[model samples]
Structure formats: C-alpha cells, structure tokens
Target: MELERAVGTYLRHVALERGLSEHTVAAYRRDLDVYVEWLRARGIVDAEAVTPELVADFGAERASAEPPPAASSLARMQSSVRGLHRFLVREGRAETDPSGRLRPPKTPRRLPKALTIAQVDDLLDAAGPAPGSEDASAAQPASVRDRALLELLYATGARVSEIVQLDVDDVAQGDLLRVRGKGDKERVVPVGSYARAALDAYLTRVRPALAAKGRATPRLFLGVRGAPLSRQSTWLIIQAAAEGAGLTAHVSPHTLRHSFATHLLQGGADVRVVQELLGHASVATTQIYTHVSVDALRDVYATSHPRAR
Candidate 1:
C-alpha cells in the first residue's frame, strides 16, 4: 500500500479510536504530510521501500537545511514519523518499523522568565482603577474583571484556559479555587487574600452588569458581550496590563504562572507542593523553578557577601 494512503488511515484511527483532540490530530497530519512528501521525492511511495537509513536521512536533511527547524519542531516531526511507522507495522502494512530507532533532537532547557513581585503588583494595579483617582467611579466593569482575572492567574498559577473555564461554584470555602486543568483533571488551589478581594469585587459589582449583555453562563470571566473570554482575549488583557504598568518586557498569562511558581520557591515552598498546585504531571517539571530560585540566590550572594568579590 502507498505510504501516503496509510498515513491517512492512521490519522483517522487516532482521531476516532484514540480520541485525540482535533488540534493534536491536525498537527500530526501536518508533520506526516511533510514526511510523505520527502519519501515521494526519493521515489519511495511504497511502505515496504522505507528504510531506517531513509528515516535517518530525513532527520539529517531537516537539520542541515538553511534556517533549520527549531529543536522542538524537529522533535515533533520525529515523533509524528515514528508514530506513523509504528501504526503501519501494527496494521501489518509493514513487516518492521523503520522509524522505531529514530530519536528526537534534544531541545535546550529554556528556563521560564518570571516577573518580580513588584512587577506583578504593578501589573495588578494597572489592571484596575488607580487608587485616589477621581475617575475611579468611572472604572468600567471590564477593568474590574481584568483585575480579577489577573489576580486569579497569579494566585493559582492556573493556565488561562483553566481560569476561563471556571464556574461561579468553583470557588469554595477557605478561599479555595477548584481548577480544571489539562485533560479535565481537577485540583483545588488556595486563593490569596488580594485575589479573593478582587474576585469578590468583580463578582458583586461587575459580572452581573456584563452578564446582562447576553445569555447568562456559568463561565467566570466574560467579555463585553457576556460570552466566555477567549484565550486570545486573555493574552491581550495581560499585554495591555503590562503596557499600562510601563513594563516593556513581553508578558503573557504564562509569565504570570512562572512568577507564581518562582515566587513560591523563593519563599521556601516545597517543589512537590508547587507541582501539585501547578497540576504538573511530573515533579521533574516543577523542579525547573528551583533553578530559577538558585539563580536568584547566586545573584544575592554575589552582591551582599562582603568577601564574594
């Protein structure tokens, strides 16, 4: 059978039987399409014609190309190729998987950039009405909502998707927030006093006004038209707040998340505790923040220790 046709069959199986999300399936399809094209160029359209060397050559070709693909992209492409060959073998279309031994390129560990506590404070202040301003009375419902959204993001370190998915009932006693993270996994994270106050203000003063604009929904954050806030809109909100705070650095929801974890680590929180709070599937993922804290300690030691220089 043609390798290209077999790729289509595998994609369908993943989408329908494995229940992978459309977004993930589409990504696999794109990567596999490139692989198929590469195979066709070598006059190897038949599945049985594929060899381990051919797969290795494909990786080398991508790596040596002008403006080579980033390590992450190359890794994803290799994963797609490996999955395709494995599927073909399982289906008896191929006697062996040529791409089985292929390994993904190693991506450098890029530590997440976290904002300082002061910067986070400034950002939150910018998201709401300025203190002692006469126009405080004129502050819009959207401003209140923005403040709550930012506060909740920092307080829980929840992804923007989780924050937007929140329902009114998700907030429980003791200022706990029940967050639904990736794969619909639920975890309860504590809300700080500042965040709780911000949420209270938005819920009591702003959400109702916005909800009146359209059909009522259980979503925590709503747009001007009362629809659930989109991920793009959430990013824009963070960007606008950062600009208002006079922060030239690029700030996104993930930045707030990084800050939350880093600040916790700097404050002596356990890595395992942070892992649970962030809903990371692995403690190894949470340990990255420890490196951020170590960097901070080194900076402090260099500046404050009298004999360091």
Candidate 2:
C-alpha cells in the first residue's frame, strides 16, 4: 500500500477506534511524515516492501547524524512507527512489522543537586537586603519578598508555583502552611520558625507597601502592581537568591525540594511518608533520594575507615 494511504488509515484507526489524544496523534503523524519523506526520496512506494533491516539502518543513521535526537525523542519516533506497523499487521496488510525491534538510544539520568543544611541556612539568611545603606525611600527592600519565598519554599517543600500563588490565608501559626500542590491536591506542611518570621515581616511591613497601589487580591505575595506573583518570577527570585548567597552551588527551586526530602530521610523520615509529603504519585518516585543517601554513606565508609579503599 502507498505510504499516504496507509498513514491515513492508521490515523483514522488512532483517532476513531483507539481514541488516542490529539497531542499524541500529532506526534505520531510527525514521525510517520518523516518516514514518508525518506521513502519518497529513495523511490520506495509500498509499505509491504519495507524490511526490518531497512528500519534498523534508519535507526543507525539517526543515531550517528549530527544534531542527533535525544533518547526521549528517538523513543517517541520508535513508538509512532511501531504503532503504525502494528496497525498494518492487524489488518493483514503486512507479513510482519519492520519497526517492532527498534530501540531508543540511551540517555543518562542526571542526579538532582541538593544543598547542604548549612548552605541552605546561609542562602536563606543571605536572601534579604544589606542593612544601614542604599535606596531612596524608607521602603523595605525587595529581598524581603524573596526571603519569605525561599524560606517558605524550603520550609514546606512547596513547589515554586505554589509559593508564588499562595495567599495570606494559606499560612497559619504553629509553623504550618496549607499548600495546594499539582491537580488541586492540598496538603499541610510545617513552615519552620525562620520561614514564619520572614513571612511575618513581609506581611506586616513589606507586602503592605508593595500592595499599596491597589486593593487586596488575597495573594500574599504581590508584585508592585499588587497582582499575585507568577511562577517564572518566583523562579527568578530563587535564582537571584542563589547568586546572592555567595557560595557557588548550582541551585534551583527543586534543589531546595530535594534537600528537604534528603534531610528528612537523613533524619529518619520513612520513604513512604516522604512520598506522601511530596505529593508524588508513587513511592518509587521518592526512592531516588534514598539512593543519594546510600551513596553518601558509602563515600564516608570509603574515606574514613582505616582499612577501607
């Protein structure tokens, strides 16, 4: 069958019979379109003429090509082609699926970077402004907002999005915060005394001045125009704070989250409980930090023991 005709049939099957999402169908279409272009350039007109050897050759070509695709991208292409061939086989249009044995190129998983507890303390303390100097007015410095944000983020293990979107009502005394995570799921997390103090200062002094330009919008963290802070802005805030903290550690908002989880685990919190606190869908997702902790122990054993190598 012609590539065009077979692809049309496959798409109809995907959309109507299999009920695949539009985004997924679009990705499959893109992958198959590339295949069709390759076939046309080589003067190959029929799907039945395709072979596993040819498919394997194409995989190799893509792997060695300059600006080669990442494993995730290659995996998506393989999935799309495999699905198409499977469809053709089910209809008895092809003897076998040429794309069945394709494998994606390997991609190394990057470890999450975490801040040490002392480094975290230094970063948070360094977040606010330098006192006894600078600026025109008697207003509070911008770091007041950033200090509260970083403190709250570390204290509650709240996502940057959640922190930026939080309101005055979200915080309560006793160092507890009511955090709404992804998919509107809510969990109560303890905000350390430091976070509470930063929050108190911001609410009492800094936030009011920042919100002086407009009516209260119920967002605790407000921009100059009194709107709720955006996630991007929140990230920029963390990045700026990381720089100002003066120790060169490649830090991001997630680094604090990882630190929170690792510190909790190091202090003997159960892995399963950490999963629940982080709002992870499964315990497996939270197990990576345990691997980090284990590696640390091994390093200590290797270095400190007299007979260890």
Candidate 3:
C-alpha cells in the first residue's frame, strides 16, 4: 500500500476508533508526516519498502542535525514511527513490523525543579491580596480564585488538568480532594489548611460571582465569564504569580507539583506515600523526588559541613 495512504488510514483509525485525543492524533500525524517525507526522499514510498535500517538511519539523521532534537523529542518521534509500522503489520498492509527493533534515544533523567520554601511562600503571597490590604472585598474575584488555584495545586500536587476538572462536590469531608488523574484514575488527596482556607474563600466568595456571569457549571474553577478555567489559563495564573513575586525564572504548574513532592520528601515523607498522593502509577516514578532531596542534602552538607573542602 502507498505509505501516505496507509499513514492516513492509521491516523484516522487512532482518532476515530482508538479514541486518542486530538493532541495525540496531531502528534502522530506530525511524526508520521516527517517519516513519510524521509521515506519518499530515499525512494521508499511504499509501506512494504520501509526497512529497519531505513528507520534507524532516519533517526540518526535527525539526531545528527544541527541543534539536534532533545532526547524527549527524539523518543516521541521514534514512538510515532514505531506505532505506524505496528499498525501496518496489524492491518496486513506491510509484511512485517520494521520498527520492532527500534530503540528510543536514552534521555537523561533530569531532576525536577522545585522552588524553595521561601520562594513558594513568596509566590503564594503574590497570588493573594497584597500585604496589609485593608479590605479583602476590594480584591477581584479572579485574583481570589487564582490564589485558591495556586494553593490547591501546591497543596495536593494535582496536575493542572485534574485540578481544573474538579467539580463542586469533589471536595469531601476532612479537607480531602477527589482528584481524577491521568487515565481517569481517581485518588483522594488531603488539602492542607492553607489550601482549604483558600478554597473556602474562593468557593464562598469568588466562585459564585464568577458563576453568576454565565450559566452554572459543575467545574470548580471558572473564568471571569463563568466558563470553566482552561489549562492555558491555569498556566498563565502561575506565570503571573511568579512575575508578581519578582521571580524571573519560568514557573509552570508542574513547578508547584515538583515543590510539593520535594518538600514532602525533605520532611521525611515516604516515597510510597508520595506516590499515592501524587497519583503516580509506580513508585519508581515518584523516586525522582528522592534524588531532588538528596541533591538538597548535598548542597546543605557542602555549605554547613565542617569537613575540609
């Protein structure tokens, strides 16, 4: 079968039948498009013409390009190519899966960047009303909501998607938050007192005001128009708070999450407990924070230890 036609079929299958998200489908399309172009350049336009060596060469070429793709991008590209070949074999369009032996580029495991406790405090303070504001009523509802959102993110270590997907009823007794994580997995995480207080203020004072601007929705966080807050908006909230705190560095929602895990580990929390709290599928995934804690310990030891340097 023609490579382009097979690629189109596979993309459609993944989108309509396999039920992949639009973002995922787009990524597959992009990666496959590049793969197909490379194959065409090599005079191997038929799906059956694709070979293991050809795919490996393509990866090597991409890796050797000026300002070569990062390990993560290379891995993603390789995955996309492998998936296409697998689909071709499964559908009998190709005699065999040429990408079966393909290996993703090894990516260095970078430690998660976490804010110091003082820096986090500064960020949270910036998210709230300025120090010594005489009347809380003077604060915009959106400002109040942003503070609550930031607090909830740091407190629960919930992904931005999970936090924004929260419904009004998700907060249970004992300051517990019912979070729906990746793959629709639900886990209950406790909200710290600070987060709970912020949530109460937002729910009682600000959320209703935002909700009144449009029809009611079950979504916990809303924009000024009462529409559910988007992932992009949540990112912008973090960025704004970081800027307000005079933090020139990039700040993402994941930064709060990294800080949450690292701080917990520094406080001597177990990795297993953190895995459960962060909704990580494996303890191995949560173990990265241990490295962060160790790095911090080393830094302290280097600074404070009496050993000869």
Candidate 4:
C-alpha cells in the first residue's frame, strides 16, 4: 500500500474504531505527515519499501536536528510512526513493520510542580471572594465564574481540557460530577463542598446572565460572550488569578492538578484512590505524586531536624 494511504487509513482507525480523542488523532496526523514527507524525499513512497534502517535513520535525524526536539516529543513522534507500521502489518497492507526495532528515547522523569496549601488559598482568593463571603454577592459575573472554575479544577484535579469540555448536565448529580476524560472515558469525581458552593454561585448568579448573552449552550463554563470556555481561555483565567495573587511561581491548569494530587497524598489518602480520582489507566502514573510527597518530607526534615547537615 502507498505510505500516505496507509497513514490515512491508520488515522481513521485510531479516530473511529479505537475511540481516541480528536487532539490525539491530530497529533498522530502531524507526526505521520513529517514521516511521510521524509520517506517521499528518499523515493520511498510505499509501505513495503520502508526498512528498519530507514526508520532508524529518521529517528537519528530528528534527534540531531537544529535546536533538537525534546525527548518527550521524539518519543511521541516515534510512537506515531511505530503505531502506523504496526497497523499496516496487522491489516495486511504491509508484509513487515519497519518500526519494529525503532525504540523511543527515554525521557527524564521530572517531578510535577505543586503549590503549597497557603499558595492555593491565595490563588483561589485572587480569583474572587469565596461564595459566602460578604462581598461575594456584589462580584462580577466573570469573577464569580472564575472562582468556581479554579475551585473545581483544584477540587477535582481534572485535566483542564476535561473541565472545559464539561456540560451543565455532567454535574447534575449534586455531589458527584460525571467527567468525560481522554478517549471519551467517563469517570465520576466527587465535588467538595467548597467547589460545590462556588459552582452553585456561578450556576445561579452568573451562568444565567452569561447564557443570555449568546446562543444557549449546555456547557458548564462560558466566556463573557457566552460560548463554552476554551482551553486557552481557561489558561488565561488561571494566569490572571495567579498574577493577582502575586505568586512568583509558574502556574498553569496542570499546576492545580499536581497540587491536588500532592495535597491528597500529603494528607494520607491512598495512592490507589488517588489513581482512581486521577483516572490514570495505570497506578504507575499516579505514583509520581508519591515522589513529590517524599520530597516534601525531605525538605521538612532538613529544616526541622537538629542533626548536622
């Protein structure tokens, strides 16, 4: 089969049959586009014409490119190419997989950055007054919504993409929130009292007014113009609040997620339970937070102990 056609077929398979998310599929498309172009440049346009040496060469070239890509990026690109060839072989489009011997470079495991409890409080307060505060009733609609948005992000430790894609109906179950994560997988995460109260204020006091500004949307978070809040918008909201709080640390949507996981582990929540809340397919992914907790312990011990340094 032609390499381009095989890539198109594999992309469709992952998007439709395998139930991968649009974002993941788009990434695959991008990586494969580069791969196909590289092959075509070498007069190798057919799937069967690809060789393991050629695939290895491509990996080496990418690794040595000007301003070389990050290890995670190279690994993802390799996975994309590997998946394509494997799919082609399985479907009888090719006799052998060219990427069989192609191994992704190992990326360094960087511990996630999590804010302290006091810092989280400061960030949330910077978003707006809490739901029951004396000035809460007089806050702007956007401010009210920001408070709820940040609160939910920290409370649930959900990916910002998942949070932004949420619909009003997803939270209709009172204390339980039905979150649709990557691959359209659904998980029920409990909403804490603080987030619930913040949400209540947004839903009752702010959402209605915002919804009336534009066409009706079932989306839980809306922009000032009333469209569903986008991931970029959510990032901006987090940045604005971080700045208002006078925080010097870099903060993003994922920072709240990291903080949520770290705080839970520090408070003695089981790692397996945290794994479930995080919707990680494997507990290994969730265990990284344990390292973050251990680091915190080391820091405390270093400062508090009377032993020689």
TM-score of each: 0.84, 0.65, 0.85, 0.95
lDDT assessment of candidate 4: 0.94
Candidate with the greatest TM-score versus the true structure: 4
By TM-score, rank the candidates, best first: 4, 3, 1, 2
lDDT of 2 at 125: 64
Q: Per-prediction count of colliding residue pairs? A: 0, 0, 0, 0
Q: What is the lDDT of residue 30 in candidate 3?
A: 90
All candidates: CA RMSD in angstroms? Answer: 3.4, 6.9, 3.4, 2.0
Task: List, residue by residue over 1-309, the lDDT tens digit for candidate 2.
Answer: 887899999998987776664556778899889887876787777999888987887778777778978878887887777888899999998888998789876667656678889899888766774222242134355777777788888877767767776778889545778877665677888777777877877787778878887776888898777778887787787777777778687778888899999988888899998888887878988898887787678877999999996
The lDDT leader among the candidates is 4
Clashing pairs in 4: none
Query: What is candidate 3's lDDT per residue for 95-157, written digit by digit as tens?
Result: 899888888988999989999999999998888863234645677777889888999999999
Stronger candidate by lDDT (2 vs 4):
4
lDDT of each: 0.89, 0.79, 0.87, 0.94
lDDT of 4 by residue, 83-143 (tens): 9999988988888898989989999999999999999999999999998899998998889
Clash count in backbone of candidate 2: 0
Residue-pair clash count for candidate 1: 0
Task: Give the lDDT of residue 190 in candidate 1.
Answer: 96
